[model samples]
Target chain A: MEMSAHNCRLVFVVLAVSGCAPPDSTSEEQLRPVVPGGFDSVPVPVHNPLTRNKVLLGQQLFFDPILSLDSTVSCATCHRPDAFFADGKAVSRGVGGRPGTRNTPSLLNIAYHQLFFWDGGSITLEHQVFGPLQNPAEMALDLASVLQRLESIPTYREAFEELFDEAPSLRGLTQALGAYQRTLLSGGARYDRYKAGDQTALSPAETRGYKLFKGKAGCLHCHHGFLLTSLRFENNGIAISKEDSGRARVTGLKEDYGKFKVPSLRNVAQTAPYMHNGGMATLSEVIDHYDQGGREVRGKSPLIQPLGLKEEEQADLEAFLHALTDTTVLAGIEGP
Target chain B: MNYRNNIFIAVNLMVLFLVGCDAATSDTGSTTLTLNLNAQVNGKPLSTDPGTTFDVNGTLISFESVRMYISEITLINSNGDPVSILGDGLTVPAKNEDDEDISHTVQDHIVLVKQDAGIDSYDLGTWPAGKYEKIHFKIGIAGTNNRIDPSQVPAGHPLAKQTDYNNHWNWNAGYLYLRIDGKVDTDGDAVPDDEWAVHLGTERFLRQVMVTHDLILEADQPGILDLSIDYGEFLRNVDLSDPDQRICHTMNNLPVANAVANQISSAFSISTDRKRTGGSTSADG
Candidate 1:
């Protein structure tokens, strides 16, 4: 009954080749996401496959504050669905009103991401779930305490047993949360529609901005592909502080200082306060930072150089970023 | 009458042969053994209590916590052949939910040794009852096991997220081999003013230790392999006065980490007498 990773990958490919949805669909109703044309299939870990019951349980746990030490803040406290799963703040507030160090990132289309966190500390979503749960600045509860809290809830105990065939455990809790987050896919934007042969999907200014994003603006250097990110670490010349060395904190390499994950531009219009520290207040500020060839910092990427972009070009680029937003991504999932 | 007598003799011989086979099976059966790790400082028993302080190089130092991961354990027989001791199979979740069994060989069974957490002893799985010439074990986890997803492991597992203490680095870096935190008195006030933390990790720092001893395991009589870890030897040549040299997180400073890693193999010695296995013989601290 157990499937090997090779066989699971083979099944994923076969499902993709055929017109049918993948077997690891989070909903009983096939995901049937209208992804951007040429968007690759979502990469699911072979160990934790998505299921309807598991996703439902994960979704319920995601909003439940019981995971926190004080039972006040949940994963949804910082990752709000209305703000494209990212709280519209420079830094998120956690349990006991402790201030988070970095900006809260959007979980929308997180399935396509290869790494998690601003520093890319965790490779898998399952492992990433523990970072916030244990960080004193975040939900602020140890894994032992979180498991014990879940064990007390009858509905949680029964749901975990039904889905994972075990008591409330680290594997079940993380896998369920990961499955639910994977279901928050967003690809039915006007940009995707236009790419899918819809002529009236974009306005003239937005279409011009799209051209600049690939051409003069040179945004595609790091933010390439349908996911709008290379999913690699780069030191985009944000002013570095002694406290936060960015990727170097995890990698322990001098060359990796100030480097952080290049975030996806999907739903950029909704999730304001850009950059790892949320230094930029608006999309205009973000474009200006890029046009000015980023900040002068140690280990800054060599690709960044002054663009000398006209006033109207920046506006057009912002319009194109707006077109990438898909309001219907949160249609089925209820509010927290 | 002569044919009936011969047939009865043959049937009696068959019964005797079956009884002999059962006797041999019972003698060679596996018995679960226990491994007791006793911490000592300068030939004296060491305790994890906050009030317990030891005189080290004319300075008083007290250990706050001592934890480590021991893996790849094996027993060498008299013939020089190695027998794996902890490979019964770890239970992990299957790739598919419909899978009947959860058993998988993710890695060699590893044990966490933490005196403060009251986990100084480990129940080594059943091994063939016999004499083992030497006990071989690695100080840290290795390969895929070190980098296994933390969330996927079962609760209460050494590498699981729900472990009692945090021994893990970020996802890619893996678990620490050994973590020893303590405070030392630099000014000789005996108040232990300075804090010191020595953490060694990564595959590069994995050190294999072998103790040559006559470890006997008897059928139905579980054997105990008692070991004494000298805290004095572990902190030898490490300067506790300088704040810079006092700490090693295993990555930032290579020299400090290297010094700590090199001393680990020498810090451990097999106790001839089962001092901790039987009862407290030395100071119970």
Candidate 2:
């Protein structure tokens, strides 16, 4: 069933309030970790409720190369937790050294995303898993083959039975991965601390840069909220031709040509190179590109305008972006 | 029963119910109607090369983008019974002066056409096996659906977000019924000198095109209808040489929009040779 943004949000709230699942001995109340101020409640789907066993299983699956057809590449190969869930490459390299067209987006705080992928093709995290796993350049494994491979493994079969009380299935696999990804949240950034009533959390330069970002730069229009992105697609004037239709490919709309989703600013320092295509290698370059008000392309968002920021102002803005990195989210992935 | 067991039973029941619904729908033997859309400049397929300028009237022009919204499709049977090709039933809150509910059904009513994406086809959904005479559809969204704040619509709806439809003008709170962005070369130098953007939307810009044809559908067999939209015809009357007519990005310019809408209304034709015993229509608009 297709859901509107409002209705989708309502569904999340309703499911969350109703506890997603009935109370049981194994279904312990998993309290959501405290988020930064201004962050909305973490939206959870009804079918995939969070549980300790499922999360652990998912983390293992995410790091295990066995999901790949050749057993050489894994989800972690591109989305390493150390690199803020984004591979430090212009575009992601998959199995057999094949390169993808778009960059691997940071998975931090992805549970709050209304849409998946830069193109917004997949509507749910569970649905998004099949795209990479089956893509020839990525894991290069079909769903049936992947499931059969997992079922063949004694450890995975035993774990699936223990957690879901069933044999390994496609639904359980995707759900577990989705649940673990939801826990990859970021809220311990200095910016988050500053927002939570700690005045000294940000340096004076960083604070000044925040003011410019909200005021002169007008980045707040699209990159507002606690997660820092409105999660809507926009033509930031990246493409010069019709080669990559971006969000237009998904919606089949002409006005969406060269448009891509506005990514979150959390842990912005670590996830580089930036942009959908990873054209900009540094945050300073990204800021410069935005300052010039994007390229001269059709369907460019009207909100993007030349800021004409001074050299010092540019450095200050870069400093503010650096302050958004949250190392605590990375700490959880160290052992597992 | 234990909570896990109860949950498992509920899931099994839901799956069973869904399977039953699918079986029932497939048992009806409903014929599928596919709408095929193709774009052409003059007699040739539309090209994306900015350097490939076409002679429209006395001026040379190149299109950077040609996109529009097509909705509210209705097929008139031989008996004159009008069948509305409904899209998914998702209500969008109106964003115009008069607030209204803009409804969409899950029957593939809205489509976006791009030159680079090649030919586009939409599965309009199943219909009773019969012969259709006339195909009616709007060039832009109808007034009811045109005025809604796109952001308020469900994410699944075509016009849910400005980015989703790419046809909406947030400032106007209305859909851009048609958008053709390109450049016009007045000096005949093969290089575009001035930008030409025609954005048509608002309540007044909505238009419907009716093509008279013999569309036949047989039981267990589908019908095919081929349609084409000629860009040359779309710009035939619009004077690109005149600066006043060169650029229009808002509803305030109704004359330009009306001219394009009139051209769109007449751009559709039923390819009699392409007709077959299938439930699909191949047409360009």
Evaluate candidate 2 and give its CAPRI docking class based on DockQ. Answer: incorrect
Off by over 4 Å in 1: A1-38, A330-336, B1-31, B57-59, B91-104, B128-131, B170-172, B182-196, B216-221, B245-248, B252-255, B275-285
lDDT of 1 by residue, B64-109 (tens): 8788888888887666778785554564432222212232456576
lDDT for each candidate structure: 0.76, 0.70
**Per-residue C-alpha lDDT of model 2 across residues B123-241, encoded as one tens digit per residue:** 66666666677788887777456544443343435564432124555323456778787899977677887899888776566778887776766557765557777787777778998
Give the per-residue lDDT of model 1 (tens digit) for A1-336.
121112211111111123445443233333332334577767666566665567667778888878888988889889876677899999988989899889999998798876689887775787788889888888889877888888999988898777767888988888889977776677778988888888789999999999999999999999988888988889997898888888887767899999999999988999989999988999999999999999898899998888999999999999999999886665543432
Q: What is the interface RMSD of each candidate, in Å?
A: 6.9, 13.0
DockQ per candidate: 0.28, 0.03
The most accurate candidate by TM-score is: 1
